[model samples]
Target: MVSVEVLNNHPTGGALCAKGRAAPEIVASPRRLTVPLKRTRPRGAADPGWVEVSWDEALTEIANRLGAIRAESGAEAVAFGVTTPSGTPMVDSFEWVERFIRGFGSPNLIYSVEICGWHKDFAHALTFGRGIGFPDYDNADAIILWGHNPARTWLAQATRIADARRRGAKVVVIDPKPNGSGQQADLWLRIRPGADGALAMGAIRHLIATGSFDADFVDAWTNGSLLVDRATGRFLRADALWPDGAADVFVRLDASGSPVPCDTRYTQQSGGRLRGVLSVRARDGRMISAATAFELLVERAAPYTPARVAELTWLPIADIEAFNALLATRPRLAYHSWTGVGQHTNATAIERTIASLYALTGACDRPGGNRWPVPPPTRALNDYNILPPEQQAKALGIAELPLGPPAKGWITARDFSRAVLEGEPYRVRALVAFGTNFVVSQGHSERNKAALNALEFQVHIDMFMNPTAESADFVLPASTPWERDALKIGFEITQAAVETVQFRPRMVEPVGEVKADYEIAAALALKLGMHELFFGGDIEAGWNYQLAPLGVGVEDLRGHPEGRRFPQAFRDEKYAVTREDGTAAGFATPTRRVEIYS
Candidate 1:
């Protein structure tokens, strides 16, 4: 039984939010579907004509129909749609589903990247070549909540922020409304929406103009000193000027006005002192004037003055100046934003600007700054090579977006509807969705419904029959957490700040003919002759494989329902050290340095 007393263990200090307290009621609701139902009517029919079916019968019919569709229309006609793990834990099945789809020869995996953290991931990867890590609230002297409202969204993080404020950490909240986080902030800037990029650029200009940035870190650890060609707007490679210089090696003007290799060893030995702008001659005897990437960034940010940003964002210039002043003085500062900033059309630029500002302060991967989480030990689950090269080229959003695809051959949720309805690049005849509420969750519900109506076959696996399920040809019942045995290694919101691993056994027997999502996936894989690839229909085998690197097994977790913690300690400035191979272990990027230009 799930007791209300369990709430005490939560990070919110026994303060259970309405949703947390209502979880038991929602799980035991009468509307829960406990059996598989097959629709016998045609597409767009008024009545679904759902008929109860046995698990074996439902799996067989789905496999046969999908096989027939694939044989007739090719594998590109099929697609898979999934939502975030908070609403549905189908994220855990991502690798298995990808394996199944690739083995079946399809390249379409539609997901909620655009509406979630795709912009943040893509922007940070483009700039720092890694996902933006969570802030270290415990050690922070100051925190900026930009476009994020954690109080109502993530109670655990909000609790930590509240505790940080109690310990005298200055809090600044930048949002359009008086949100829950804003209510408790030391300074709240109610700026206009969609103006985050401008504000960030303005702040960067202020920092650069006032010499508030960490110049030492920028010169030593980033590509800020690498010279950029004025003609092509590309980094000036050393090989272009010196015949024997490496092609990947970049050049920076030394004290003698000559180009030198801009490697980390040279920067460390030179004490991070280099010319910001210089003129040089190429092998072709052409005189080229170049400026360092830092100078170029300053030039780009020059136009966004505080007054201009105030006009654009409808925020006070004084407030913007004050915020920048606070950021400049704080020794341990961190800023975070989420979906609100990621939902814009110019989200990539916005997130990149935010990351650039953060990098200027030298607050990344530090004790009291934004720290990268210690990742759980696990094998690479997504087998990228499973999909053939030809099918990968047909992904829907590649030509349009250019970036933002999670994998080389995946489509975003924004493009799924059009790809299915119009079939512009290719037709998508079938959709197998797990826990996605497309009808109400996606924009333009009518259009999403029409796209669903266009599909030749649709399968929905969920705990309840939602609008999406109502339109699906097959609605398979899914097991709840209460009726299943599961393992969770870390808290998603906290980013493993308090590292833990917990195993939850079945609290009660399953209500009816319901099965776990992985079980259904395994059963379908068996029917498709991929049982061996899926570990002979064994979910435990998959878990064990995932846990192999951690030196733990399912057997080890069987008796410990409360879970255990593995010891770990955070290290500062770890990114600048050398690797086991004796090479520099700088930020992961094309240049092996933080790329403000890219």
Candidate 2:
């Protein structure tokens, strides 16, 4: 594989405008001999051991084993898994897998959203009913770098940061360590790790105390003033929740929607250096009150002030305070990128708090500060509805199912290991994985392998032999993104174009026994005697069905790789505040109002 470092400097602007320029011309070279984790499955090596077998043998064994397990233990025993590839073209293949599992009533389709990006999604949904895509990098005045460091982790987004910097946007970085991007920041607030929510709450408090908050925006566009009983719902006084009311401490919203803060908290003493207030909002579009909102406030930031943060983070607080002051004075955009900040227990809360900075400053969904651009392959469900069908199904399951609320699919990677080991409610005896790297994706090294050992069977699909594929009971080889027809889209919201859809051709034949993901899926469906539901026995027919409603067909997309750019953004009707029943639509919160206390 090409190194990410080498791909980092690929041309941009008109240079990158060339189609297929960004992708490598070659998929991979023919591989030499490689070793496996274990030679066979009987020794308890976590995941059935690697054994060389024909594709037919592997497929037959996988189907029989999974079928037997499902027959013995019900659909809950089967789990489907996949990983995030940089340019994954087989999303629909995974979708097909999810559909099959759902069709069989399984609750084990796992994803990385909750583990890495769901906080941003939930936060954006609370604010605008949809998670904003990449930020508008070119149109910012001030940029706040929370726990996120894009320089090393996401080189694609780092280019935008460099461009934003060239245009005189003041860059401020807040992190536990002095990351590469911190060197370029006007100010670096090196506060303690896991203290981001504290810094954000402090900033909000400062904004309110200093009268810099966007009250008009809060009152008009949010649920800032809803009342609720402290004990019954997800709301309450900051003091009641935490004994150290005004001291340096953090507050949080519990599962029950109540505002609570930790005890034994003290403010970092920094000689009155950095402190302030800002308005915050919940999902129902309510703004938090300064009084009740104190739970979400940061009192210690006032004390850590500048000097304390400098001492704690080792980045001079005066410089940090200067950056903070500049951001407060000017328009600011906050970008949340996945890096070190996204791999921790506090990731979701930290991301949400960072997003609150944009909302507090009235920069959310705007031109400069974290603007959310519309997506490609547009569909209608009124404005601000981007919950794809599968996600919607998952959310509905959380709401209506007798099973406990939905597990955090995106955030709970470790739990997968745990569930496989413990099998509390039911055993996750079988795992069907595609392009997933267990060692790379999970942390605790020993536990991951052990969990794999505990599984009754492990089926992996991939183009090349990977750590995961080498450890599987069955390895179903998969095709490359280039060696398959695909509909491609990007999450980047940028300057040049709007909602471009492209098609990629199968550049080469399959290597060895490899097959396109779609083909493998259809074949599996056929083997399972459910061929009609999978693709109606024709790949092109399925593709045509997916494209017909868009007024485009397979022939139109064939032979053209650059694809077409749809002209107009779909203009949907405005969303209503109240339902037709004359009653309010309940917020996801227990009280269903914009939660000020929470």
Candidate that would win on TM-score: 1
Report every candidate's CA lDDT. 0.78, 0.54
TM-score, model 1 to reference: 0.94
**All candidates: TM-score:** 0.94, 0.74
Candidate 1 lDDT trough over 10 residues, lowest sum: 265-274
Candidate 2 RMSD to the real structure: 10.0
| Candidate 2, superposed: residue stretches over 4 Å from native | 1-26, 32-52, 85-92, 123-128, 153-155, 175-180, 189-191, 231-315, 332-334, 376-411, 495-498, 570-597
State the displacement of the C-alpha of residue 14, model 2, in Å, after optimal TM-score superposition: 6.7
- Model 1, position 277, has a per-residue lDDT of 73
The lDDT of model 2 is 0.54
Candidate 1 wrong stretches, greater than 4 Å? 7-18, 264-275, 388-390, 406-409, 493-499, 580-582
Q: After superposition, how far is residue 139 of candidate 2 from its true place, in Å?
A: 1.3
